[model samples]
Target: MTWNILVGGQDRLDAIASVIRREQPDVLALQELKGWSARRARDFAGQVGMHAHLAPSVFGQPVAVLSRRAPARTRSITWRLHHAAAVATVGGLTVVSTHLNPFDPERRRREATWLSACFFRTRQKVLIAGDLNSLDPGTDHSEAVKRIAPRYQRRHLRPDGSVDTRAIQAMAAAGFVDVGRGIGPTVPTEGLRQDEFGDFRLDYLMASPPLAKLARYVSVRRDEVTDMASDHYPVVASFG
Candidate 1:
């Protein structure tokens, strides 16, 4: 599961915990973990009955990965990203919790490319999940994106007034497959919709071709707790 829990879920920790406890995904990738200390993240992991790793970030927007088993290794990746990404090696799979620049498409492009190529030294199956802040190809979010008030749309579009897609394209070129593509949009939960944001997919769970082929199912989890817990919803992808 991958979710951008707004501002570290400070005010809604219980609600967030409730949703997580109910879903019970084997692995969780989280973004926008603002004000999160390693201790705080560990405590949250304990609360959820999972082992956790918090990738420390200079900007306070750290990404995290929590899993059923303790990871063998954990590392931080900050290659031109607005937020630090967390990597955990669990079993034979390498999981990456990533968050790209929320505003700059060019920076997001660079970040995506770097992340896509990072773990290729080994033939390890890789699963990347979190708020990529970009849309995949073959999905038309233009209508919803355009509804987000002109001034607030620059970051989501090119100067040509079209949705900018270079960031995601870069990742695809590196051989990453969108495991949850066409599942659904992942943002602007029921109570959080505003003029500045509309329904669209900004979060994802991507896998290397080897891992992608084993994916069994993908879903977007939404309900009362999710609506109030964060502006962005959670997504889950299953594999054999």
Candidate 2:
């Protein structure tokens, strides 16, 4: 499962912890973890009986991974502003937790290329999950995007009149599949009244072929608790 918890709001973290306890995912990926130190993340993981690896803060935003077993390795991949990937290996799978640049499509494309390269470099099954900040142009999220923020179209649309999907395409070209691509929107419209876009599908769980085959189900978690916890919703993917 993966979620961007709104800059790690203390109450939000508590809420996330509660959800984690209930869901008990094998691995949890987190982004936009502002104000969360390694110790704090570790403490939280301990409370939930998991092991945590948090990237060093970059302008207060860091990515984190928590799993039932300790990861064989943990590292951070830095790119443009407020964009990075927190990576770890657990149960023979490479798990990446990332948050891409929210406003720059071109930069996002570059970041995606790098991220995909990382996945291809390893032979282990890989799960690349996070807030990609880019949408698939082939999918019909137009109405949802319009309802959130009409102005969003002006910023995200390419000159050719397509939503910038290079980043997503990059991953697909590298043999990764977005398990939640058409599942549902991951962001909620309520808190987005002040933003450029309302509820949209911004978070994702993309995996290599091996991992994709292992996925049994994937969906967005939308309940009173998740809705009130953060602007974005949590995406869960189950593997057998």
Candidate 3:
């Protein structure tokens, strides 16, 4: 019942394909994708001998799900605040991949509400994962990640920051635990102008409390999976 999740920040299709090949996950979730990216995912899945479904969250932006087994309930949930939520049911679990709005708190809150509602209505266990665009629960910030910070704070309180923690709190209240927080930092980028690892963890793998018991492993792929994969690393969580 384990699955692999990939968020498409600025990832290369080839690298993404490599991860799928290496992990051999039952399911893969990709975010921040364009129409081309979707095609690439399908192509890569073909190469790896798997199946892929590209579900666009927004008009131009998309989220994709690749599976070894056909999905039972795979669909896209539209939202006003951010891109959209891509959901699929596998092994009796409802898996959702989302990236929230960064520019506006009101929008994020609205999106969060919509997402919570969707989670509430689902009968299957929930597993939520993606780059939520929030401050890492721990870490100091470089001016870059701080300058273009999301409007909302993260649910975990800190000394000083203009983050909107409301959305995270809302999700938690509905029973989703931040996987990045519990497992450890998932993002580990390094460079002169692009070193955000010293900062807190923003990537995540949230899940309903009940699903926590089913989790056998939770981790982020820190290795350089590819030369042009993405600026943000991929977070992977597996359940049994």
Candidate 4:
């Protein structure tokens, strides 16, 4: 599972815990963990019945991975990224939780390439999930997209002024399959940042070919609990 949790869920930990308890995912990747400290993370993990592995902060906001079992190994990617990518090896699978630069596509493009070189191309059993904040080539143009400010929209435009999808396009070219591809939109739950993005599928769970093949299903959470928890919805993937 992966979710942005909207600026640390605006202090709504109980609602967040409620959703996680109901879903019972083996592992959950979380982004936008603003104002979180090691002690807070440990306490939250205890509340959710999981073990946490954290990343270094970018302006006090980091990313994290919570799993049912302890990680065998862990690492972080902080260079050239908005929020550090939290990595953990648990149950023999390498899990990467990341949140890319939401305001810059060129940087996102570079981040995507760098991430591919480091992880996707290795043919390892890996799961990369989080708020990519980059649109795919074939997704629909929603009504919400038109509401964004022209300046912010300009950031996502290609040189020719079309919507630039190069970031995610680069990842697919580097050999990762978007495991959450056909799943519904994962953003704009409630109280979303109006100037940022449309109601699109910005969050993702990209898996290596082998791991993707083993994935049985994927789901996006909606409804009362999710809306109460964050501005973006939670996405879950299952492999047997």
Candidate 5:
């Protein structure tokens, strides 16, 4: 499962933890964990009976992964990258949790390029899931974006007048299938009052072929617990 809990909202961590407990996901990819230190993440994981790996956040919004099993290897990848990302190898699968820059598509492309290259280098099955911030241009969400934030339409469009799909495309070219495809909008339109983007599929769970085959199903959780938990809904993917 992947979720972007609001930054510095430790007061709401219990609400987020409630949802996590109910879902009981094998692994959790969390982003926008601002003010969360390694010790805090570890303590949260321990409370939930999971092992955690937290990436140091240069922008105060760290990414982290919590798993039922201990990871064979874990680290933070932020060298030459716009935002920090957390990586962990658990049960032969490489899981990455990240949050991309919302204001710059060019920077997002660079981050995606680096991520794709790293995904290719890893021999194990891989799953990259988080708040990408870039939407698939081919998919139509312009009306929604305009409705929520008319100003963002101009900023979100590329210099060539195209929507920023480079990040997702890069991952696709690297052989990752966006499991979030066909799934309903991951962000709630009602939450647009808090954030700029409208009901778009900004969060995703992209998996390599091997990992994709293992995935039994994928969905965006929108229960009462999730609806009030955060601006972005949690995306859950079950594997066999």
Candidate 6:
């Protein structure tokens, strides 16, 4: 019943593969995926002895799920904002891997509402994890991301990358609790690069209160395998 989840940006099959080998996560959720190749995703799942559910469509590229056990049911659906959700199962638990819109707050909020409805309707245990391209604690930009000058920093937020507190709030309101607080920032990819720690906990793993009780550990890092692959750190959450 224990599992690991990885969330990051694209072109990271190698890094992801490495994590799959090392963590042996019973379930994995990835953002920024491409291709219609079931072989590639299935190959990775095969390497880890898991089955994968993939959607190579829209924003942040795509979203995927690799589970050690095949889900009882699987479905893919897209919200108005290009955000996608992969609903799967591990025993009696229902898991959804999703990444919300990054720039447009309204779209993100709208999508959150849709997601909330799904949660209310599901009767099984649940877990939701992904990039969300979101930030908590405030609606303003990081001083560093801001100080880079609007011209340079704007690249940091693009095509709907805006702070949506309501999105986070909605998840909370839906009874999902973030496992990132006090654990440290899971962003900026690298931990030793800047003054102090420039990481912010943007990526997340949330579960229903009952499911949270099953979580054994939640760790954030941009270590060797993850750092070399992408610009965002991987958030790994384990639940039994």
Top lDDT hit: 1
Compose the digit string of candidate 6's lDDT tens values, residues 77-107.
Answer: 6545475777787787777777777656567
Best candidate, TM-score: 1
Query: Residues 1-240, candidate 5, lDDT per residue (tens digit)?
Result: 999987744677888888888889889999988888899999999888889999987654789999999999998986655568999999888999988877788888888878888875434589998988878745876567666665677546678766668888888888888876888777762432354767688898988887787888998888767777788888999987
Task: Quote each prediction's TM-score.
Answer: 0.95, 0.91, 0.76, 0.94, 0.93, 0.80
Query: What's the distance in Å from true for residue 55, model 6?
Result: 2.1
The reply for model 1, stretches above 4 Å from the true place, is: 120-122
Candidate 4 vs. true structure, TM-score: 0.94
Judged by lDDT against the true structure, how good is candidate 3? 0.59
The models' CA-based lDDT, in order, is 0.84, 0.79, 0.59, 0.82, 0.81, 0.64
Model 5: per-residue Cα lDDT at residue 141: 64
Q: Write the per-residue lDDT of candidate 2 for residues 1-240, one digit (tens) a residue.
A: 998888675666778788889889889999887777889889988998999998865543888889999999998775443556788999788899998878767877887887887676434588989988888756865566566556566556666766677888888888888888677677663543346655568898988887788888998888878877888888988887
- Distance (Å) between predicted and true CA of 172, model 3? 0.3
lDDT of 5 at 146: 66
Clashing residue pairs in candidate 4, if any?
A: none
Which candidate order results from sorting by lDDT in descending order?
1, 4, 5, 2, 6, 3
Point out where model 6 deviates above 4 Å. 1-12, 58-60, 121-123, 138-145, 148-164, 191-198
Better of 2 and 6 by TM-score: 2
Residue 132 CA displacement from its true place in model 2, Å? 0.7
Better TM-score candidate (2, 3)? 2
- lDDT tens digits, residue span 84-148, model 4: 89999997699999998787788888988888778874556888899888888777553445567
RMSD list, candidates in order:
1.4, 2.1, 4.6, 1.8, 1.8, 4.7
Better of 2 and 5 by TM-score: 5
How many clashes (backbone N, Cα, C below 3 Å) per candidate?
0, 1, 10, 0, 0, 7
| lDDT (C-alpha) at residue 113 in model 2 | 83
Error of 2 at 28 (Å): 0.4
